[model samples]
Structure formats: C-alpha cells, structure tokens
Target: MLQILNEEGEVVNEKAMPDLSDDELKELMRRMVYTRIWDQRALSLNRQGRLGFYAPVAGQEASMLASEFAMEDEDWLLPSYRDIPQLVFHGLPLTKAFLYSRGHFMGGQIPEGVNALMPQIIIAAQCTQCAGIALGLKKRGKKNVAFTYFGDGATSQGDFYEGLNFAGAYQAPAVFISQNNRFAISVPVEKQTASKTLAQKSVAAGIRGIQVDGMDPLAVYAATKEARENAVNGEGPTLIETLTYRYGPHTTAGDDPTRYRTEELDNEWEKKDPLIRFRKFLENKGLWSKEEEEKTVEQAKDDIKAALKEADNTPKQKVTDLIKIMSETLPYNLQEQLEEYTEKESK
Candidate 1:
C-alpha cells in the first residue's frame, strides 16, 4: 500500500517524490495530456469506422506513465494491447500506432534500440515470452531486465503461473506488472481470484511482490524502480500489482458496460480520475497554472489531429499483399495455385 498522493491529491509521502526538475515534471504532464487526448481520439476513430477496435486506457494514465518512466532504455517491455500509452512513452512513433490501429501488419515492427515487443493480444502469452527473454539475458550476463504487463484477468491463465514460477526458480531478471483494473470484461477481480490481492499470489511463486497505489504515479514509479533494481542486481523476479480502474469499455467495439455495471459506479470512478488527481497535485505544488493547462490540452489536441490526418493519408494496403508477405519460398503446389488464381484474375 505505497502512496505519495492521497485521494484528495495532497502529498502524503513527500519522501517518495522523484528528484524531478520543473521542466521534467512539465514534460511528463504534457505527455499525460497528449496520451489522454490520443486515447479519446482513437476511440472516436474506432466508433466512426476509421480504425479497428481499440482498448481505452482512460482511467489508468498514471499507472502507465509511472511504470514506463521507471524502466531503463536497455530494458525490454512486453506489453498487452491495452498499453498504448506505455508504448508511446517508450518513444514509439504516433504514426506507427495509428497504422497499427488501421490493421497494418508492419506497424508493430519496432525499430532497433527501442527494446519493446509488439503488443500481445493473446491473454498472458507475453508473460512467458518475457520470462524467456529475461532468462536469456541472465545467461548472457546482461544487466537489462524484462517487464511484462497484463491485466488482472490474465493471471488466471496457465502462462502467468508458469512464467512467474520459472522466473523465480531460475532467478530470471524480470518484473511482472499486474494492472488490476477490477473488471475482466465484466468479471470482477474478487470473482476471478479467491486471493485477497494479486500481489499475494506471487508469494507462492517465491518472488517479491508489492501492492502499489496505481492511481498515484509516484507510487507506481517507486515500486517499479525498486523491482527493476532488484532484478538487475540478481535478486530475481518481482511481481507488482497496481490497483486501478478502467472507466470505459474493454474495447471500442465491445459490449456496453451499462449491460453489466451501474452508471453510478462509473461516475464515482470518473471523480477519481488519475489525470485530474495528478493535475491537482501539480497545482498544489504551484507547478501548474489554469492558462498553462488550457494551452497544454490545446496543443495535445492539435498534435493528435495532425497525427490522425497523417495516418489517413498513408497508402492503403492491398488485400492480395497478405499472401505475398506470408511466403518467402512457396511450395510447388502453392506456386501452381497462385498461378491459377493470377490467370483467372487476368481473364
């Protein structure tokens, strides 16, 4: 239960604050603002059929930003599809992100030195992959750690247990971050697990586990930074359960929450929005002004609009190109089939 800011956004743990310069804090706030704007715009795009399905990180901005900021450049990140903000914070281009949303195959081909994996849609798959990567790094005597992100529901999958157990047993350099947003597609966390907390589950796997206040960015950063340090220092893996909430649907094209949840509860969560909480924290420090806040949000909106336009202008991919991209050396039978298809098309 680590926390820096309380529910009212007052500094409750001054010692936990990062040694950040005013410029850095301002920049972080800018990124948060931009990320929120991008998320909303993407959701709108999906609704308008301009893009494919999207997972909104509307209520979890602090959790994403802090965890991302805690990582090193050389470290690897295995993120679930919902972690768009984490990818953006790690220097992924906005154009590529939009391209991915538009269903482009090459959009996820991350550039070198980025050390981020493609977003995994299969639940809990990236956890095992991260464990393997961390194990390999450990064998190679590398200092880098691997951080894998997943939701609360993913913990029920076999891969989650297998990955965590193996990482602990072999002393793999990895961190497992469980962003417990309470609902796994309408299934509450309590119904998903009998355990009192997700972090407690890690104890059975023989790893250090901590439950952090996810809405508090500084708390998340402190927890992840410590976990990362322990991994790099040969102390093996750690599990961090970030208690947070999602204020939107599971994905843009998913079922409406009103079918399963109360609008009153939704409104309550809205009042506890991480962005607003952090904004108040900054204001209390005299680090944010009303005019500056307006200007920041306006700039973010402009940037997002520009990025969306760029995504729209990009050349559309041909449906036939999928087959061409799939094979390097086509078998004789496949070659004959392709030739027959091409001949029929020419007719």
Candidate 2:
C-alpha cells in the first residue's frame, strides 16, 4: 500500500511525501478539521429533523479532501452522494449543499462556471458521467481532467467497468477515486468483491491503478496529484483505491452500523483517524496549535449555521416549479401539469 504517514502521523516514507509548503500543509489540516465539524453538525441537524437525507462523512476526510485538494478549479468533478465536501470545495455553495439535503430542486442545478454535477445518489452513475465529460474535454483540446469518486460497492456494478473501459479505450483524461470505506451500507467490502485490492481491478480496463493508505492525507494527495498529471498528459485514466473506514453509520437514514460492524473493528480504525494523524504531523512542524483548531471549529460551526439558515429561508419548491425547470418551453403535457399544479397550489 502507498503510505507516507503511519498511524501516529510520523513520516514513514520521506521520499513519497508531496512537496507541500508549510502553509499548504496547514491548510490541508484545517480543511479536514472543518469537514469533521461539519459532519458532526450535519448529523445532529439530521437527528433534529432540520435536514433530510444525510450521509455521514467522518473518517474518510483524508481520502476525499486530499484528492480534491490536488485538483484544479478547471477540472470537472463528478461526486457520489457522500461527496458533498468535494462539491463545496470545487465551487458549489454550502447553502446549496444544505438545500440539496433538504431535497430542493435548485440544489440539482449547478451554478454557471462550476464544473461539477449534483451529488449522484445512484450507484456508480458518476463514473460513467465522468468518463463522458473527460472524453469531451479531450475532444475540445482542454487540458482539464474529469475526476470522480465512488465507493467500493460501486466497483461491483457494471457501470463501473463500463466507465473505466470507455475511458481506457478513448484515453480520456479521467481520474477515478474509490473511497473504499470498508462497507457499502451494511454490506462489507469483502462481500462486494474478491479482488485483492480494488485498484488492481483497473488492469482489466487497460489503465494504471494504485492502492493508497486512505487515512494518510499526504499519501492520498501525492497519489491524486500524480494521477491528475498523468491524465492531463494523455496517459489515459487511473483508478485509485483509498483504503479507509467510515466511523459513523453509512448515513442518517435509519442505518445502525453496530448491527454489521463490531466495536473492536471501530476502535482499531479510530487509532488511525485522519484528523488526529494529520494534526500531529502539522504540530510537529509547528504549523498547527489548539488555538488554530479551536478557531477553525468555531468558523465551521458559524458557516454551517449560516448555510442552514439560507436553506431554511429559500422558498419551498412547488410541483409547478419543478415542471417549469425541466425545459425552456414546457411540452404540452408538462405545461398542462404545471398549470394544474399552479392552480391547485393557489387554493
């Protein structure tokens, strides 16, 4: 496995560490800390019925954020349902994220210039979409790559192989990241596939692949940076499998992880928590302090509070609004439906 920092956050492989400046390293830690705060708050909001349909993203911070940190703004991102952080970082607003969780139709609409799709709830759907976007970028002679994220269970789907094979055949500039967080809902990764490593599955599609220590932000950053470079250089796509674990239940949607996972297993992965590991590494370099962490925590809380407020204030979407947004000029059927709903709502 590719590893730069061990469980204790000590550099285990100096040669493999990315050449990140002190500020950049600290920023990475800050983002992870902020994301942790957001995850915690989101879960509480979900429990209080203030938000709808949330997927907890506690422990896979390094895998998700570090990979996104490696990408440029011009690159397109196709994210899974659990990848709200990547979308927000890639230019989607936090308010929109909250609206999305609340099932607002506007949440699906990407703002002009934000090179991303809405969080895809369907399994592995983004993989195929990412491949198509990458191919389009190549044909347009753009240097940007299309990056995507999926879970280990997504690899078991036919769309996963089809997407990779299409990208390989066309040599599309795409980087596929598999955040293998040990379980797909209540199902374990082992039952999803027999492949020794999810990364190796890329061989069948004639692309390069690597497995990285997902809990190690430095390792994930280095690998994703290299993969992005390779893609933009016309070396075809790359599949990266980040071996990580999610600390919370799969989602806030009636999932009881305790039913499928053990306390012992959870404790084992807790020792490798990305936030703690990265915090130690930053402190060792005198880049992070409790003061900074506390500030970040407060900032994250304030941001979430404001974003949720914005979402709450947005006008509730109506059936007519959904019908109208479907097209510029609605079809006869939709037009009739829209009028029907509009009149009914007026009552």
Candidate 3:
C-alpha cells in the first residue's frame, strides 16, 4: 500500500509527497470541514423529515476531496450519490446539494461551465459513463480527462468491468477511483472479493493499478495527480483503490450497522481520521491553528444554514419540469400523462 503519512500524523515520504501549495492545503481542509458540516446538517434535515434521503460523506473526506483536487476545471467528473463533496468541489453550489437531497427537480441541473453529470444513483453506473466520456475526449483530441468515484461493493458489478475493459482497449483518458470502505452495506470486504486488492482488478484491463491508504490526503493527492497526468498524456486509464472507512450507516434511512459491525471497530478507524491527521500536518507547518479551525467550523455552520435556507426557498418540485428534463420534446404518449399530472398537481 502507498502511504505518505503514518497514522501518528508524521510524514514518512517527503520525496513522494504531492506538490501542493500551502494555500491549496488550506483550501482542501476548508472543503473537508465544509463537507462535514453539510453531512451533519443533512442528517438533521432528514431526521426532521424535511429532506427525502441522504448518504453521508463524513468519513471519506480525504478519499473524495484530495483526488478531486487533482483535476482541472475542464476535466469531467462522474460521481455516485455520496460524492456530493467532490461534485460541489467541481463547481456545484452548496445550496444545490441541499436541493438535490430534498428531491427538487432543478437540483439535477449541472451549473453552466461545470463539466460534470448529475450524481448517479445506480451502483457503478458512472464508471461506464466515465469511460464513455473519456473516450469522447480522446476522439475529440481534448486535453481534459475524466474521473469517476465508486465504492468497494461496486467492484462486484458488471458496469465496473465493462467500463474498465473498454477504457483499456481504447486507451481512454480516464481515472477510476474505488473508495473501498470495507463494506457493501452489510457484506464485509473479505466476503465481497477473493482478490488481494481491489486495484489489481485493473490487471485484466491492462492499465496502471495502485492501492493507497485512503485516509491519507497526501497519498491520495499524489496518486491521483500521477494518474491524471498519465491520462492526459495518452498513457490510458488507472484504477486506484483507496482503503478507507465509512463511519455512518449506508443511508440516513433506517439501517443498523451495529447488527453488522462493532462500534469498537469504528472507533479504531476514528483514531486515523483524515481531518485530524491533515490538521496536525498543517498546524505543524504554521499554516493552521486552533483558532483558525474554530473559525472554519463557524463559517461552515453559517454557510450550511444559508444553503438550507436557499433550498427551502426553491419552488417545490413539479411533475411537469421533472418529466421535461428527461426530454426536450416530450413523446406523444408521455405528453398526455405530463399534462394530466401537472394539471392535478398544480391544483
């Protein structure tokens, strides 16, 4: 496994560290703090029955943010539902995230200039889509690359293989990141695959493969930076398996993790929490301080509140708009249904 920082928050590989400016480090930390606040606020909204459903991104901060930090604004980002932080990092507004979880129709719209798709709700669906997007970029001779995020369980899906296989054969400019959080809801990683490492799955596709400590932002940043460079240079796709953990239930809906794993196990991972280690690293560099962290926390809270208020202000989802976004010119039969639903709901 590639590890740049040890569990005790010490850098063990300065030679392999990512070339991140001090300002970028602070930005990365701010994004992680912002994500945590969003997760907590989302839970509160869900419990109050104000939001439909949500998947928390609390524990996978380094796994999500650092890799995305490697991408350019022109690159394409494909994501699963829990990848809201990366999507927001790519250009989606914080308020749009709340709108999305609340099921507002406009939430699905990608903001202009953000080269990303709406978060895929299906497992591993974005993997194949990412490959296709990358292939398109290659055919068009674009300098941009494509990146997608999936989980450990998704490795079991057919889309994962199909995407990788095609990307390899065509030498597409793509990066596949699998955040192996150790569980596919209830099924443990040991039971999910017999392979020694998820990254090795790329061997069948003839691409670069790497396994890294997902809890280490520096490591993820370095690995993804290398992968992105390889892709834009026509070296082909890379499969990166990030060994990480999720601290919360799969979704905010009714699910009990205690029935599947031990609280002691979760506590163990907490000691290596991404934020704590990265915070310590920045503090030691005199780039971060205790008071600075508190200010970040307060700023996150206020921003989250404003986002929630914006979501609350959005017009409720309409039957017409939902159907129309699916097509510019509605099909003949569906047009009637849309009219009926809109008439009924509008009343």
Global lDDT for candidate 2? 0.94
Question: lDDT of each prediction vs. the true structure?
Answer: 0.85, 0.94, 0.91
Q: Which residue pairs come into collision in candidate 3?
A: none
lDDT of 3 by residue, 125-170 (tens): 9999999999999999999999999999999999999999999999
* Selected candidate, larger lDDT, 2 vs 3: 2
List, residue by residue over 1-61, the lDDT tens digit for candidate 1: 8898787888889887766677767666777777787788888888789888588988888
| TM-score: model 2 vs. ground truth | 0.99
Clash number by candidate, in order: 0, 0, 0
lDDT of 2 at 208: 98
Which 10-residue span in candidate 1 carries the lowest summed lDDT?
Answer: 317-326
Best-matching candidate per TM-score: 2
lDDT of 3 at 152: 95
Task: State candidate 1's TM-score.
Answer: 0.93
